[model samples]
Target: MSSTAERQGGSPGGHPRGLYFLAGTELWERFSFYGMQALLTLYMVKQLLLPEFAENVWGLAALRGMAEGMFGTLGNVGFASVIAGLYSGLVYFTPLLGGLIADQLLGAKRTVTIGVLLMSAGHLAMTFDQLFVVALVLLILGSGLLKGNISSQVGTLYPQDDASMRDRGFAIFSTGINIGAAAGPLVTGAVAAIWGWHAGFAVAAGLMLVALATYLAGQKHLPDTPPRRHADFQHPPLSKADGKVVLALIAVILLTMPAEITYPMVWTIGPIWVDSYVNLGFVPATWFGSMDSIGAIASAPLLVMFWASQARKRREPDSLGKMAIGTGLVGVAALGLAAGSFIFPAKDSVPLIWAIACYFLMGVGWMYYWPTTLSLVSGVAPRAVVATMVSGAFISPFIAHLAAGVIGINFKRMSPSAFWAMDGAIGLAGAVLLFALRPMLNRALGTDKRKDAPENAF
Candidate 1:
């Protein structure tokens, strides 16, 4: 059924009012999500995950002894990295299945509600040490449902032909996300510093509860989700032509893996770096992670406007090209950090300016890619299989974060400069590959000098 606003037929704005509601919901949801993210790595290493507990729990002592015997000592940093990787990777990976469930069974509305509730429960569960793993599981599952579906719902607001509006809508929605991301860590980190980690988590739980209320109150204003008949989990087989476009899109998405692998550096290794090397007494390490979000929130409007202006002038780069630029920017950002690391002597703190510069550049780089990818995937997906295709794009991050976990393990093993430089090169390489494949990708995805291609066309 069409919303009353839609039925009224003379809506003042071309867009739906529900968009703002959804955007607000997303803002708070991200606030909760990133707030927890900022706390996760440090909490595991410095607070909850004790070595004695590890040794006593499920023969982990023997495993650690074996690991230490082979690869020196597995310190808290390494353990924290592994945990961060596992947590982050699961967050992305489960969205693949979550998107499917929404499409095939629950519909986007119910799925997102369930996701928020689960996350709220998980945040509350974080207060208990015994329920830690359970909390993680709930969070992972909740994020999977909420993350993809909410964005998917945003697209549903616009008609299929309104690509420009959809893209702009996503940018606006992304701005909300960045805003939340920026605020969440700052608030949570400050609270944690003042009170304690559990207190910080309690704040997150409160925020999520608030988010749920906000979403529920505004449900009428949001886009409607058509009821779906539950069916056995099965995707309709793609035609050969559809297969080519999907394969191409997947290939391009996979190209982002290298940059994605390094994303955790800001959160996983960042706190440790600040504590071990930077030695900034007044600023919390979680605040450094907030830099990326702050930068992104600041830059999103400018970038979105720039893209819109470029599109009007017919000078806008294709999505693949934009993503390539983003990939390179990440490398540049990493290089900036690497340079800072080179200048700062070992065991000494670098100037806060260096960290800020690195994070700001990273934020700029992410602006070039992340929202564009969301718009791209949402725009190109076949209507019958939209969620699945979005899920496929998420696979890039899934692989990246999993690799990040492995790379994070070695953060303490390698010099900071060397580690940043190596990953910088990886991002640069991915950029080079993507740029080289631009022409082919444009043809495959059918964005070159053309109107919208048929949904199944190569």
Candidate 2:
């Protein structure tokens, strides 16, 4: 049988060609983003925020004063965590505005293009000490524009009725994300180790250019952006059912926050932890940042197959259940870190295997929740507000990062074991809440009727 994509004149028996193009574009974009991110916290703690170097940055004193005013006498590490948190948080938050612009004013493609240019400029700016704050502002704004619109475009590739294919497409797209994420830290970390931080930033800038080129190359294959909504245009009011679903989705986003808060810590404070505690013969700590993505990439196919087999037996998990499982696994991953910390103590370096295991588990947990949630939102959100809803889903991570940053400030004060255990407990709490709320969510989202065949039902 000709697959839906094939029937729609996409790649024969596969997905739309545009899917690969979008995935490719995103791969390089993530490569740039993650590459820079892998360096940011470490750079700040080790060099950039130090008194001598900090003085060279144009706005450092004022920014530090404002941060200290808000948070109260932050040490260098705490201050870096706060900045990292704010940067990560705002990147997710801005997508809401980006979605509005795409859905109402500029359309997805043009907005994405503008985003690429701004991000490219941002990456370039990262190479200069004077532009540190400015670079972050640009990257945050650019990412806001690119992230949601590109994701929404994936949904437009397949007919809305083909939920299964849409899910599969997202999985494939996520693979690109994992690959780039896995590679970014390794490459940039190695580059920084060999040369300097600015050299690493330059590489990220180059990668962003490649991303832009890939996006432009594939313009002909992408979906036509809908005409911009006019000032007088009015979407039909959302039905009462959609209103309920919206509320439920917002609840779901909130429920995911516990795990979200714990996950980014793997990167934000993770490198610092690894550098201080892990027994690395020669490997840079930033390389450890790749482990979660590596784990996710390795686990995706096996999980898909496992889910497929379970589906045949009518015992597959619903989206919420899978997300709960994912959340729990993330907790377990944090506990693994806690265990390592306890066993090794602060005086002794932790075994390399412990960090590897923890990061890998976190990745596996990510495979279960992140893409599943994206597919769920894309499949079920009301069409008129789909883009906004998709963007809003990111708000979970936004809140999580902000909270995580605050939590990260305590890393210096707390024992490593206590710190990780707290994170573990938070993740487990989220899982418990998600599991408890599953039935309620089902009814609210109108998926309760299809409970018997939930594998493909969502």
Clashing pairs in 2: none
TM-scores for all candidates: the values are 0.87, 0.93
Candidate 1, superposed: residue stretches over 4 Å from native: 4-15, 52-73, 159-168, 223-227, 230-239, 279-281, 308-315, 381-384, 451-458
Q: Candidate 2's residue-wise lDDT over 1-458, tens digit each?
A: 13444434647347887888889989999998999999999999999998899999988889889888887888888889988999999999998888888888888999999999999999999999989999999999999999888887887888878888877887778778888999998999999989999999999999999999998997877888764756656689999989999889888888889989989899898888888898987889888878999999899889989999888888788888889999999999999998999999864389998799999999999989987897688667898777677777898999999999989988888998999999999999999999999989988987677646554432
Cα lDDT of candidate 1 equals: 0.79
What lDDT score is found at residue 104 in candidate 2? 80
- Cα error, candidate 2, residue 439 (Å): 2.4
Query: lDDT of model 2 at residue 71?
Result: 78
In model 2, which runs have C-alpha deviations exceeding 4 angstroms? 1-14, 159-167, 230-234, 454-458
lDDT of 1 at 293: 81
Model 2 scores worst on lDDT over the 10 consecutive residues at 1-10
